[model samples]
Target: MNSNQTEQGIRTLGVDIGGSGVKAIVLDEQGLTITERSRVKTPQPATPEAVLNAIASLASEQGEFERVAVGFPGVVQYGITKTAVNLDPQWENFNLGDALSKLLAKPVKVANDADIQGLGAIKGQGVELVLTLGTGFGSALFIDGKLVPNLEMGHHPFRKGETYEEQLGRAALNKIGVQKWNNRLQRAIANLEHLFNYNTLYLGGGEAKNINFQLPESVVVIPNISGLLGGIKLWQN
Candidate 1:
């Protein structure tokens, strides 16, 4: 709430673009919440143009803001998307940062949604791994507050010819029932622990709310709002 922020002290309008919905929230320079979260259903077909329109509409409901931070459910590189994953193929290679900056008339930064989530969840020390289990599995790794680029760990092999995402995503949970899905998640966690040896692990995304078992001392479940909190940090150098 100072000169570094907007006239109203709003620093950034954070947008989280997921497979099912587009959500936005306003935060001040100090990372204090400045507005109620607003959400819009992701359009049918979920094409780039459709999602773009949805984001614009969602942003409009949040009043004024100086900049934007977008958490996209895809492989985003320097604001350019490299993979579609759960989104439309048209998103591949799309320069999303440039597109949103132009559309919203505000500076924009975009990154893998899970990576943004990690920014809000991590203590910025040791190796931290964040996994989001929703429409799809999303992951991000960080060490001492620095991101190690993007890791599409979800698509990596897990079981017999199926990927981790294929086994742990929301669809898998609904199709297999909660108990079986939880078993798959247990195995996934053990596998990830052995592989990454992370100091902490954070579970997030919409479906994370349904987790019914206790996690290890080092593992924690974070709310999806962490992704919006990350938008504030996204502006930091």
Candidate 2:
């Protein structure tokens, strides 16, 4: 590896804060996991302070690390969260990166959870889209490895005047049953294909495993771990 690669290869702490869980892992510069993941239930109410404590606790167990990267289940810009759909309202407008940096005493970078997942999954060749089916639907778009931040496609009207998240998220999957939810997902995929004309689509998040139907050739199912693995990309530049 080159000097830059060697420098980056130092340990990095990657944290993914979701609606239901907070997960952390240590990674090498190349985004390979160097330690087993550490996770805890997201605290009740999941306020900024509560979630911060959870993340900090997990980080504390991760051993020494040079820097930190985070993936949050919301729209994040410049380390500040702009929206929190499934999380507590207090998360909106929170400077999560700054807060975590202070608590962890390490430089931190943060982005939309799906954006991070896409960074770990995309092939850097063409228009790519990632959809995460977890507590609530999340989306990320990319073109030749360049991220289009904060897409928030989940809030867009999909069918029956309901948002995509209403019909596709984990709650929806549970309410509608797996078979029906899978049908809705298939239809949504078709709609998205025409909307973005993306070269590839990656499906992830906790609920992705519930998909029981055949996916289109252009679509691939990615592991939920992609959210944490993609953390390294935040520091690549």
lDDT of 2 by residue, 116-188 (tens): 9999999998999999999999999999989989999999999999999998988888888999999999999
Look at candidate 2 and tell me the lDDT of residue 226: 97
Q: What does candidate 1's lDDT look like per residue over 107-168, in tens digits?
A: 99999999999988899889999999989999999988899778989999999799999999
Off by over 4 Å in 1: 1-10
lDDT of 2 at 91: 85
Q: In angstroms, how far off is 20's CA in candidate 2?
A: 0.9
Q: Once model 2 is optimally superposed onto the true structure by TM-score, how far is the C-alpha of residue 18 displaced, in angstroms?
A: 0.6
Candidate 2 off by > 4 Å: 1-8
Worst 10 residues of 2 by lDDT: 1-10
TM per prediction: 0.95, 0.96
Clash list (residue pairs), candidate 1: none
